[model samples]
Target: MSNKKEQLFDIGLFKRLFQFIKPYNLVFSGVFGSVILIAILGVSTPYLLQQAIDTNLTNRVSEGFLFFILLMVGLLFAEFVFQLLFIYYSGWLGQSVVKDIRVKLFNHLLRFKMKYYDNSSVGVLITRSVTDMERIADIFGQGLFMIFRDFLTMIVVSIVMVIMSWKLSLIVFAMLPVVLYATKVFQKYMKTAFEEVRNEVSNLNSFVQERITGMKILQLFAREDVENENFKTINGRHKKGWLKTIWYNSIFFPIPDFCASAVTGLVVWYGGLASVVDGTATQGVLFAFVMFIPKLFRPLRQIADKFNALQMGMVAANRVFKVIDTTSQIDDTGKHIAKNFKGDINFENVFFNYVEDEAVLKGISFNVKAGETVAIVGATGAGKSTIINLLNRFYEIKSGVISIDNFDIKEVTLHSLRSQIAVVLQDVFLFADTILNNITLNNPEITEAQVEQAARDIGVHDFISSLPNGYHYNVKERGVMLSSGQRQLISFLRAYVTNPSILVLDEATSSVDSYSEQLIQNATDKITKGRTSIVIAHRLATIKKADKIIVMDAGNIMEQGTHEELLQIKNGYYKNLYEVQFLKEEVA
Candidate 1:
């Protein structure tokens, strides 16, 4: 969504981009050397042709003719060699810079806090990483270095033309001011058009990504026609954005072609007349001037086109830098390594809110001893999941403290802290990978034997063995190949294999079949044994055997005790919720 229009030649942006190329100094130096050699050699061809015509061809001398012909051929071959080297090195430099940039950008995204992602569009991020990065690479591969070579060629040609005849050079120079003015206008208009193009591209990407992700919802509601109509509108805007650039190109590119032709005609007409009138211009000089004029104006024309790549690259860099400059990272100032936490968790009057001025957990406090199983039952939006988020430090607490084993959670390294805990949620996510890889998550230290043993211990080994490939079975994207209950069982095994010191089950068994529920209950018993476990479930029946039960209503703890002790409270929140919610679920 960054709409900042960067200048055509932004020094700051280029400086940052060049840092990525610092490691490839040798390759870039080779490119620079090739450009210079090509420029010097490119001018030699026309000059050598002029010499051949004036000295050898006109006099009908065979010796000089053969020598000049061989000399021109050698110069042409050298120029070809350098041109090839320039192309190869420039492409190598561009690709190398892009590779480093992509790695850095991805790493930056990985460190961003969860809140940053909550407020960002995934499609826009993808555009910046993939499409925009390509634009930046084009600036180097096809724009900057080539522009340098072309401009250098023009400069060399100009100096030689002036030396040959100052009067003819003046005529060519007269057309320049007009061409330069037109180029300025073209760059101005094209920059604006390219910026709009990039913006529309991001918009189109965002729309398509959302539609694809939510296709099931659209189908379920039978809104395909409506969605398609909306897509057409976005797709149309994207088309218009690109068409605008083409319009400017059609107008601007022709002006330079016209100038090149006019200069060539003027040189031929005026120089030809001068030769007949006073013998001031030679036939060889006129011929060389005609050729050199186009060479000089050609780069000027191409620069106008190359400016598109330059401007687009700067705009893309601006957006990319914005992401890299974002300051939304979780504070990991804690030096505690948590090598041996005792699993005791304490929330001392902790407060939190996902949105400003709307408290989700208002002065909530709780405690769970090591090796205790605590069940938290609450209605929807009663902050059941918020507690789990807070314990894992996914979101920083607004006030008060959350600690494990008397060590403040914030005063510990995130890796060390989260390494000791695992959470299994109701809506489990599985990657498109083999069952063994999904369970072990490709951890080299966690062997196949270890995963199989953990699966066996968790009582899901028989269920997995029933599959086509057993542990090696491929679970397609989001585990769409498996049932919801089967996905939950996979998640349970994944969590259990890690051997987390503290376990969290956030409504893990609330949406499973009766048969899968039995399997999950059995696995839950094994995983939660001798660990501090926090179970968040709406089903009251599942928490009957928990060491302690905490009933929450509207962000406040209504009751906390054993199941029987809480039931003894007359007309308590837990008693009513248990009667109304659990009874209906049982009857169903």
Candidate 2:
């Protein structure tokens, strides 16, 4: 979200980018050495041509002509070799640096709290990690080293021109100020233009990603036409963003070309008059200066084009660094290592809010003994699920203390804390991988036999075996290949394999067929046998066997007791909720 526009030549940004290249100093050094060699060889070629014309051809020296031609061929071969080295090594360095940065960015993302993700766009993050990283690499491969090589070539050629014929070189140099001034203006415009293009690209990515993810809703409501029109509008903006860059190029490129031509003309005229007047200027010198004019302006033109890449790289680096610099990660300041937790959860005077002054859990307090089945029932947005989030430390409480087994939850390592707890959410997510991999999550310690045993215990073994590949069947992305019920079953198995000390089920069986509901109920009963379990349910009948029922309404615990005991209260919250669900079941 920190999409600030940066200066074109941000020294701070370059300095940070160079840090990734520290490990590959040897490769980068080789690339720099190759550029220097290529520049020297590049300037030598035109000078060799001047020698051929003056010493070999003019005097009609046969042996000297052959020797000069051979020397020119050798120089060309050497330039080719150095150019190849420069290209290959620069590419290698760029790729290596990007690989390191991509990994670092991903690791940083892993540390961010859930709240950070709640406020961020998935599309923009994707662009920063993928597309932006590519642009940063281009700084080295296409922009940085190439620009250095071209600039050095120009300097070497300019110095040689002055030494050969200072008068002609002066004529050529006279037009440079105009071209340089034009280049400066062009670069400034391109910077703004490229930044707009990058922003549009991120927007387009986000729109498409959201649409595809919600395709079901769009089709259910028959909103395809409306969505398409919206897409066209976004697509138009993206196109316009790119056209701005093209427009600037059209206006800037011709100026350098014209200046180069005019300087060539001036050099020819002045050299021709001088050669005739005193025979001081020679054909060799004039021709070499003509060649040198393009060499000087060619890179100027290219630097103008390559500046686009450079600007883009700087913009990308800014965005990427912004994400890297974010400090909104879950504070893992706890040094305690949780071992064999008794699952005695306690929430003391807890107060929390997702946003300021909008409390979701108002001075809430609760306790669950070890190996107790605690079912929390409430209406939607009544803070039932919020308790689960707090218990898992996904969000820090605004004020309160959460403890397990008399130890503050925040005083333990996140890995140790989370490893002892498992949660099965309402909406299960499965990766595009095999059923076995999804179940065990590729845990090397959890063997295939154990996964199968857990699956059989949950009565899903037969269903999995009915498929062609049994446990090896691919579920595809988000488990689209499987039914919702089947996906839920897979989730149950995934959690069961972990064998955590505490288990949480948040409306896990609310939306499913009777068959799947039955399977999930049986799986639930088997998994929650001895471990401390907390179930948030909409169906009151499903939790009738719970040891304790905590009825929540408007972020407060209105009633807490066994199902029978709570139903006995006069017009109690749990009693009314139970009767309403019972009536609905009777009607169905």
Candidate 3:
């Protein structure tokens, strides 16, 4: 019962949905005009046929026969015109609404906090923004408006059937109870089926997207047969969900069809009896009711199908609206606009976690003066990356004061805050585009020559220029065509071109070959000079020349000093980590 209540037309939900239609009032007017004309013509067809037979054919008069034929022809042509207008307008309206919704949903997603993405599935988001959006459009195309036309036609036909002959009308409507009962049962089951199908689609999509993205891992580990079996399980569930809906459809449709036939036969028998015995029914009235039977039950059966679409649309809309209504956003309430930064940064008593009660960073404190270089060395999951994410305001801290140049970071606009910092990550990501476009990120203000100069400044100019198309060379999706080292080299150019006030190198040379690592090392030294720099490093070579070194373990600052200063401490965390990790690298 609760599920059924949810599928009922929530006035507020539809009111919001219909707001998309309000923009195209002219098309809406055309659809409404078409529906009314179609209804009038629907009843007129049967009445005209009965009139022609009773009046013109019964009198055996040729005089009025041609007029009836011409009138019928006129009615059909008008029906065609209205139907063409109806299809054109309704289809146009549906497409237009979905297009707007798709854009709005995408833009909304862009503002969400990184924390939201940390917990969300890319495939589920894709389903909501793409697949579900298409379903919502059908509410206008084949769901709501079509059902309205059906109901309107049914109501008009019902009135006329009664006015012509109540006895015949009563006989025809006797099947309504049985048909309505079947439809109620079908709708109850179909709604659950469609909901399950939608869930399965999201699961299937997420599975495929994750597997495809990790294809390298999949093949390297030789997990093909295992993944294929898992895929079959997911795909089987998707098929079963759709089949459940089909099973109900198979049972439900025949009920209406059988009821229509039964009602027609019963109407004819009663009409024949009335005409012969009571003299209250005419042959014309009986013939009109027979014609009206199909018109009536046809819409009834079609309404059942449209209800299925409406159920799906409503389910999709609820999901979409729920996402849009989520308040997980990095508040950009500060009005301050920043053109550049002096690069002084401070973090005091910062605490953060990706999950509740599972702290990833705890009471971390650090400071970097303008144009100073600070290197952070720690094992993976030591909170090195969390500091970088916090500096850019990617996630909100539980309790902290993070400031740049004496201004609270939270009191600054996100664009202004992020624009000043540039990072080159260990696992570099490049879009499928020309090197120059990926570097500039389509910013029209950064000319190609500026990028070239930045590339030369970082000592990677020769490598980029040697590429097939130099700066114009397309990297393809995620820079798959390039070696891992080459992708990181490109990322160096990307970070350097911006000439950021603060520079971050997140284990930048960790995975590179000797040649690319040397090039990246040179790029780092060239870019980090006279800038506020934070280096998260595994290689001793990356941290040897830092003005200050902060060693972290389990989110706490364990030691702070220069290269030689920290090594002399007895039983220090940095000393143990260096002996265990970096000492071997230097020897190699």
Best by lDDT: 2
| Candidate 3 lDDT, 232-272, residue by residue in tens | 99999999999999999999998889999999888889888
Q: Which stretches of candidate 1 lie over 4 Å from their true place?
A: 1-6, 584-588
- Relative to the true structure, candidate 2 reaches a TM of 0.97
TM-score of 3: 0.95
lDDT scores for all predictions?
0.87, 0.89, 0.88
Worst 10 residues of 1 by lDDT: 1-10
Question: Model 1 TM-score?
Answer: 0.97
Residue range 116-139, candidate 2, lDDT tens digits: 999998999999999999999889
Q: At residue 216, give the lDDT of candidate 1.
A: 91
RMSD of 3: 2.0
Tell me the alpha-carbon RMSD of every candidate: 2.0, 1.9, 2.0
Candidate ranking (lDDT, best to worst) = 2, 3, 1
Q: What are the per-model numbers of colliding residue pairs?
A: 0, 0, 0
lDDT at 147, model 2: 94
